[model samples]
Target: MSNVTRYLCAAAYLDSGFRDKVLAELLFDQFRAIPPSYGGFDLMPVIYHCRRSRMMLVVRDALITGFFVIGCFMAPLSTFGWLWTLVPFALLTVDGIRRGPLIVRALIWFWACYSVFSLIFLAIMTALIPAAAYLFASGLPFSGLYGSGSTGSVLQQFLIPVVTLGIALVYRIAIYLTLVGSLKPGAPEPIIATTHPRLARRLDYIRRAQWGNVTMYANEDAFMGAGRIQRNWSIAVELDRVRESHKPSRRADPVDIDPVELHAFVRGRLIEMRDRVLRPNEGIQRLDIGDHVVTRGIFTVADGQRDRAAGAHPMIDRNGLPRFQATAEEIAAIARHPQGGVRYYQRVTINNAGQEIRDLDGNLVAPAEDQEALTSAFIYLAVEGRMLYTQFVVTVLPPAHDHYHVVDSLPTMTSGRVTWEALKVLKLQLLRDVLAAPVRVVRTAVESVRQSAMTPNPRDHIVYPYGARLSVRELGASESLQTHIQVLDVGKYIKMIEQRLTEAVLDFLEERKVETGAYRMQAAGITVSAGNGGTVNVPMAFGEHASATVNGLRPGT
Candidate 1:
């Protein structure tokens, strides 16, 4: 419940596309759940924000309509009678539309632009029409159509507003239908938790899962879409059973090793490193050991069938979830026939000391127990045949932008601040709203119709390469790490994980009775090169023409 999470919730309330993608698009009907990888943060707060905003809109719209009706009744008594009523009506209407769906908000903008141009044209015509009529009546014989007072008053008082409203209605319906018809079928329904109890439960489950478990993903990058890659390096070494001698001798057989056992041994050592930091408040905030599988991407049953026909692994279960973890038999088989699509990793997440976000009233916005860390580092280790592969990656998750955190700074009901704030907002927006009401009404109506007619399907129609790609946390994260301390922590954790991983692998190799002369040499070279911010090319044999290149910090920098 950091400010990043709060900002994301506010963003979901404002942007329908983002809300639908996180709450609906990533869900699987069979499991009735969102994939762990895609849903990396809490979602209940987001749902709450959306529902609250919708309710507020309803109240605001009702107030605006009431005032508008009163204004219409008072129009005959005074020349500017409707002008007083327009203030509150327009103000409320503008606020309501701003909190509405993104599509409607965008349409309102276009309509406002068009209305401005139309009003200017009508104003010029209103002035010219009366002058032209006077000149014609004085110069020519006919005086029938030369009454300037009545005509000018009629045009100014009635025609301008009437024409603007008329154009808004026509334009709204046209754009609404075009956008609605173009929408993809089977889109996710609006997340109305009260109206849809089942969706609310699903959201709760996703929130709990994010907190209680480590989500998995099958992708090309060691840690894809996590955040910026702060640091990364890999090391590979050839293995042999016989000890090296100064004189030439017969070649010995290669050592037989279980890749699974080797992976477990290294993983256990990394876990021990995590265990050494017993005080959770002192060192790493989170440490998880899990199999990090690599695949082209998550695919559906249809994709699996297509791949099966092409004589390749389908990579999915009958339930349509991706086969992220391999079975013991599958692992053993892959170890015997080594490939690139499977890897095991140890993830270490470190918490950096940063200032917490506070509201305008100076209250902490995030909960005490649920403040998520912004930095995470990953260690990938795999033993394939005679070559051992190890990679270390660091990613930083920055806080969301300032604007999206407006929800935290809004006034509350205590001390009558809400009412006072509302009055102030009305005063500021009254004039602008007077001119924007017609366009707002047209846009709101169109949006309402679209929502009612096109009810979204709960079940998503997922296709290959169309499933969820980016994570919600990553999507809302800032462009880079926020502070100098965060950057320092990134380097600290990378080096820590790297030291533990290297020691674990070297020990495991020696315990297997394998020659470590070449491995030691390569390790020393890699350490020196990395310390100096350079690259080390280590030639490793996997299948044929396979080589591994270890880079320092990043490939180029």
Candidate 2:
């Protein structure tokens, strides 16, 4: 077409299908090696034209009633012309790239190339079809027979289609060999760049292991969703790309994986995968579609550790290990022993209060005097390649801050049914403590009462017994002179325990406050001395009595 004609076509496109059709062609050119006639154009002008068209908001009506038809019905059309699939793919590829996964760039390229080629083949068929029809046209000299008497022979007619089909086969093979992970043996595979050091390491080994596939997700959610916080591990994978493509039967018999060992094995597999892609000698990898996955990604290092710490270790004697104190290596060792393949890991984020928490009730996490301590117990549940969950427990010990006592444990779960429900159980104990704390001691003629109860743990088979005893000190006495006791039990407690080694602290405060109040009141002309003893004096008749009582004061004064 002439330049003027083309410009006119472009201008009119805002109100027609020309714009979309042209853009589709341009996208095809960007991704495929098709000629310009097939939509190749410099990007600048194409981008400009696209912006203009979008602003106009000119909608073009499709030949079909629906604005979108996702090509499933195009199978019948395939017999007529395989080009239908290709055209839609080119358009879809352009749209997808403008707003979708660029990682699938190669797949789109494959689609564009194959579609363009299909179009070419169909065009050839269209041309030959006309010529063939002309020969067998009605009333032609050879119309009486299957073919009109033309220069072409019966062999030539059948031969043309076969040759075209063979060309199509070759086209498909060339694209696959060049674009897929088929690197010549001894040739190095081009490594995929990733920001994470761990990911990069995995990729290097994936290539070395000759696995043809490797995918990585830096954040928790991309193609998958883990969580939004760093509390969750970043995800990654290295596998045989060809095997993935073949849609091989899902992993038979779970492959035993020691998360630590797989952590190493993954590095090897990624290196091999990269090498095969970069350097294929008739293809560096010998992987086929039906082959099982010899490699996969790695996650949950901390989870495994946490699980073992929460008493999930298989071999170690349950009684021997310290509560929630197992180290990472110890946990990793348990899974590695005896060759029963299992792999998982766990991480922790500890927030410790200044002093050991004997008890807590919101603002203050107090210091326990002796055997009490405080801590957050986190558990990670990771099994095989899936099912991830996290559990949390806060432990409170004594004021010495030396050792952690299992005073309270609370459990929480994330992702799925978690193995760390033990955390929740601890919280329940704490709640019970606060609800019934300070077992009341009252002055009674009868002997003091002592009470105790036993608590049981589901994850641990230990019985927690709490004891409380009340006794009265004898001195002298009026009915009111003896001590009075009040019982306390605070439940739903956040946890706080305070200790003060002093006598009648509140009574002392009351006497001091009354003396101060009397001094202030007298300076304004009111009664007796500003206080020598625990009592404040007052005058009688005009104001008040001149006698005073000690250690007793009304709260309002």
The candidate scoring highest on TM-score is: 1
Expressed as tens digits, the lDDT of each residue in 166-216 for candidate 1 is 443333333223223221122222344455665555555555544422233
User: For residues 1-557, what per-residue lDDT tens digits would candidate 2 score against the true structure?
Assistant: 22212222233222224444444433311111111110111223323444344333221111111111222232223333432333434344355564777657666667657765775565446445655677566545544344333324333333323333333333323322221222222222232355867435433332232221111222221111111121111111211111233343334333332344433333333234325454343221211111111101212221234345652433222332112123456555533442333322221111121224333354545652211111211222233342111121222111211111111111122312222332232332222222111121121111122111221222333311110010000000012211111001110011111001011211232322211223223222212345553223232222464542222122322
Each model's RMSD to truth, in Å?
11.9, 37.7
Per-model TM-score on C-alpha atoms: 0.58, 0.15
Worst 10 residues of 1 by lDDT: 178-187
lDDT (C-alpha) at residue 171 in model 1: 35
lDDT of each: 0.51, 0.27
